[model samples]
Target: MIQRFLAPHRTVAAGMLGRLARRAAVCALAFGIAGAHAQETSSIVIKGKDGWLFPGWGSLTQVDVRGIDNTTRLIGQARDLLAARGIKLEVLLLPDKTLFYEDRLPDGQTLSPEVKARYGLILCKLGQAGISTFDDAAVLRQLKASGQEVFYRTDQHWTQASADATAEAMARMIGRDVAKLDGRPGTGMTLGPLFNERRYGDLAELFLTADEKKQVGREVYSVRRQAESSNLVDDAPAPVHVTGHSMVQPYFGFPQKLSSLIGRPVSVNWNPGNVGPWIVLLEYVESPAFRQQRPQVLVWQMFEPTFAQGPDASGLWDNASIMSANAWLDRLKTALSH
Candidate 1:
């Protein structure tokens, strides 16, 4: 029964998995024998090829299928509840950086078959549960294939180019579902000129020692400034609300790009650190912002690797952010009730 349901969305081919395993074995052997130089400075930071650093928290081998199903079921329930209040919920599930830069993984490190199939499996489950989502993996892959760097080599956050691309794609999807949004004319944000800046990545700053950081070096990033003349504040309540981690923050230009492309005012709330998506959502719905005027659409963004983790992932999520799944849902229900 499960196979039948997932057949249509199964993206990983058995042959591909076999090829990946063979390639990984050869790379492991080569790196093990010849390249003895330490690539990682810290256990939590993975040093990838060509100065690319990835967070070690995301596993390249583990895929908790049951956890994914439970997460999706909860998301579906949230969707139904939001629908009752005339709000459309769209989940923006961002794929891990490892997916796009598999070749960059240090010598022997490669994604396991389960990790390769994880994104597709979650998407299938979300679909089955009647939750709205888009294939962000496909969008990022296309952006990478086009020679644009989707993510920074040194930073955990994505590049502005990728953010713009994803925002455009998301806008199109939102347009299809919502014919028009509630906002006055000329309320949308205006994007400013793009500028280049060089800096050390968050990973390099947080985990790497002084010597290790020098070795990794700084990377040039393209950033977009908001127009100086643009007035973002308006009396009309924003019809679209975004809730997510630092990835969707204004610094990355995701929410700004989304507002420009969608031509609607987009209100956003985000927290840095591993606060987890569950708590982030609760924080938003319970805030005075949600009570002032409920948005017509709510975009909930989350990382794909951590998607399977429930709200009560004690050690995985930050100490204060952790809670049982039922407890999280109960809070959500209470917040939305008013």
Candidate 2:
């Protein structure tokens, strides 16, 4: 009697259950496919030509471009402030890694036309403002043409050779004034033994997986150490001072080589490149180091990307470090008065 009572609806219920199962399976398959695609696309690393890896999100964004005029104005204002203190300001704008390695970029990635013109535009704007600028692009291109690696395959920083070349250029500029002051011809200085080391680049470490790190390998650089010279002393309060990013650090052999080439001891005060240039300059201005050993010429080295963006681009820097263009100029003026 129970079977007869349910038998009429049992067939209809079974049909409905079978259709629902089929629909659930289809939905699951679609979601599974989408999830896999999203995982692949969200990876931070992209494979580049010849086993190189590029950061998927490393390029400059709209915010950086929007802030260029403001950044440039601040730089010019800094020059004016330093000029008031009777100190010379030399702006060294290091070109982006992509500038030298565009051919090795990851597949489907292209440097925008605006980025291609960024360095030249920066130089032009700075020159128009009468700020002393270094032509790093021309020098790097010349080195690259001569088969010297201007930048590492996986790193955002320049090679030791490129750093040395930049130092040499700085030495030439600084040497001229020193020669004029001392009433002597500029002497040809020398560097010591070559030191070799194997290292991983910051970008490589940031983007590569363990397997990729092993596969892509590390870059070896033979850095030049400062030689024991009769003329140069280590402890003197040198007239030339360098303040910038990691590029000017002693590890990269920039200051040492710069000292060797200029025939005099040099001083360097630098920080990690990410802290932004405005903070570095402002802090240096207010520090006891600046008060005790003021430099006759200060070399401010910075990368193009960082130079393009205003201080608050990442919002990672402190309030004391980040401010508007006008505010920064006012602060610079205040710092100079003290």
Candidate 3:
């Protein structure tokens, strides 16, 4: 006992190491908890009634949002530049719901009805200037009245179901009659479990968030991988060419899924962000290579928000290599006539 007591430094050093080790463990645990917490919550705050989700802060009709000046003149110049280089430009704008429903917005919010009208005016001005833009505002308003959900619950993107509707709108825009393609596959045994867990976007992160994860909603993906040769749609497909932003990218595969929808195999281009729809549209219209192949249908994938303001420095018109609005429009007209 006396010898054990004689080793005085042993007790002090051992106690110090124990406390340090415990503190390190606590710190690691705290980090893990914080990370999980973030995953459960929405990074962007969106006030939605019931459970429906939608594109927030990125649509065309936001109140007090920034827009470019001399929109008409700029688009004309941009179009001419693109057409000379052989491209086609079609513009569409996706309006924001919040701007329209300012009265219903959370208290202390400044968005108002006048702001909505102002944004609408901007859209009208652009359309009158010859952009061949889709009548999205009317359609969206109608959809809203009918209680149809167009946007996702957790992400800024529209849902696959909404995409299907958009695809139908696109087909109609090009003057083709097409049946809506079914994103789901035939047969239960053919598809995998991945299809059952349809959560694809920010919702996935929500599923892992600290506060929301436990109660985070679970919704399976509307589209799933089918067997090697399963039927996804009911009819025969026609060759289609789609140009737009990332909103249209799923067109590459989704079309192939529908029995009547097929990709052109002509290798169209795509860009993301809030814009870039017209760039690829212009590319397909101007390139002789694209024209020679002659895709039977031209589907323009667009989001309305980018269309309201026209080109900024980062817009497709600014990039000399990818997008030109004028020559591309001429080529588009030619392609349409031919």
Candidate 4:
């Protein structure tokens, strides 16, 4: 699907370079101070090359092999439990933006060998564990190489185009595994025309000061609108459910795209903050919604950076969301059993 847009390579390349130049100018003016001093201003935001900003939480060189193994084990157990209840678990592990844009890292900042290999390692581990997952990194990389910005320059979330592309890929995977989905005809979503808007990304909004924001300026974002007249019919339960963070929110058009492509209603539950995937999953499965009508396919989306961080990672996840790995599994078991 993404390959179809490659025919306009010249046009897209010109636009891409133009945007890069604008962002580079803005970033240069915004961070006039020395690199070390600029980093001191915001502990949460990492100043990168060409006016790009990254979240500090996702360290470029942090790789915990043990953590990854533990996470894989937990996910495998969760898959078994969900399988028993006839729910097909599809794990969507989103690689960090840095993986794709390492060239844009701040001066002297480079990805360590471990960081470079972490994603592939996790994918291998997941496969070895017999867990069903997809290589989203490969999909995004392909889009990026084709001149499509899969991620925002100053935000942690994915762009609308990337979301649509991913949804298309995920739809293919789901279709192959589930064979069919149960939903009413014409229950899918309709995507409206694409529109462009200039806005400060989350990193800039949260970390940059008023003067800094003005200097950095807002970048143009391509957004897809949901057709105003389109609405999902609630006559039957949604065959698919997506539980994740801000990336999967309606604002980014991920769920809607998935619904439209799958030709079925896709129920979604997402929290903006880093609530952690474990808590997000438990929240959905434990809710009355799950008891009333459980989805046939559960798309559990998680970030690669935090994939290794267990449910009890103190500072990473909120206090309420934190718990022992065993405790989380227990709750999941109870929820599925009920």
TM-scores, in order shown?
0.86, 0.77, 0.52, 0.85
Which consecutive 10 residues in model 1 have the weakest lDDT in total?
A: 1-10
- What's the C-alpha lDDT at position 246 in model 4? 82
Q: Return whichever of 1 and 4 wins on TM-score.
A: 1
Report RMSD (Å) for each prediction in the order shown: 10.9, 22.7, 22.9, 13.1
Candidate 2: where is the Cα deviation over 4 Å? 1-47, 54-66, 175-190, 229-234, 314-320
On the 0 to 100 scale, the lDDT of residue 151 in model 3 is 52
| Candidate lDDT values, in order | 0.77, 0.63, 0.41, 0.77
**Could you give me the TM-score of model 2 versus the true structure?**
0.77
Report the lDDT tens digits of candidate 2 across residue range 1-338: 01000000011145643553344334334323111110112234557788665544335222233355456666766776787797888888888777777788766777665556667766665665566877899999999999998877776667889988898887787755344322122332355788898877776777778887877888886776555552443244556677787777766777767756665556666666557677777666666667776677888887775565567655434455677766666766776677
Model 3 C-alpha lDDT per residue in residues 11-80, reported as the tens digit of each score: 1146643553344334334323111110112124444443333344342223222232234445544444
Q: Predictions ranked by TM-score, top down?
A: 1, 4, 2, 3
| Candidate 4 lDDT trough over 10 residues, lowest sum | 1-10
Ranking by lDDT: 1, 4, 2, 3
**Residue pairs clashing, model 2:** none
Q: How accurate is candidate 4 locally (lDDT)?
A: 0.77
On TM-score, the leading prediction is 1
Tell me how many clashing residue pairs each candidate has.
Answer: 0, 0, 27, 0
